[model samples]
Target: MSETNGAWTWRLEDTSGTVVPVSEEYADQHFASQGDAESWVGEFWRELAEQGVVAVTLFELDRQVYGPMRLDTN
Candidate 1:
């Protein structure tokens, strides 16, 4: 994950801790703000569920923001 100039890059991973290949729409995109990054997950997590992703993590450069948050597509 990388954050620069108040933007962020995200990584999606599986439960086994392997990085999953996110589609271009969600890959390598820099978010405008931390809240924006988190909101992206909030809205897009169902897609992650469909892709067999069990959890998510947020980072800002080298710092962990939150997560490995379990997906609940109920």
Candidate 2:
């Protein structure tokens, strides 16, 4: 998918590829840039893991750019 001009967002999910429901505070995070989206996840991935988010998928608008990236830093 094209990586430019579209909104960047994350699809939080568990290992089963099921979407995980995070708290409202993090439920609506959308970014104008991919770096921002990556950075946000980098910062909060620990917390997300604690809350059962085992993986994440990146999307640009409705098009998935990449992922199902595991949050495990091991």
> By TM-score, who's the top model here?
2
* Global lDDT of model 2: 0.86
lDDT of each: 0.72, 0.86
> Over the stretch 1-74, how does candidate 2's per-residue lDDT look in tens digits?
23345499899999899999988777768888989899889999999988889999999889999999999977
What RMSD does model 2 have?
4.7
Model 2 quality (TM-score)? 0.88
Model 1 off-target regions past 4 Å? 1-6
Q: Against the true structure, what is each candidate's TM-score?
A: 0.76, 0.88
lDDT of 1: 0.72
Query: Which stretch of 10 consecutive residues in model 2 shows the poorest summed lDDT?
Result: 1-10
Best by lDDT: 2
Show pairs that collide, candidate 2: none
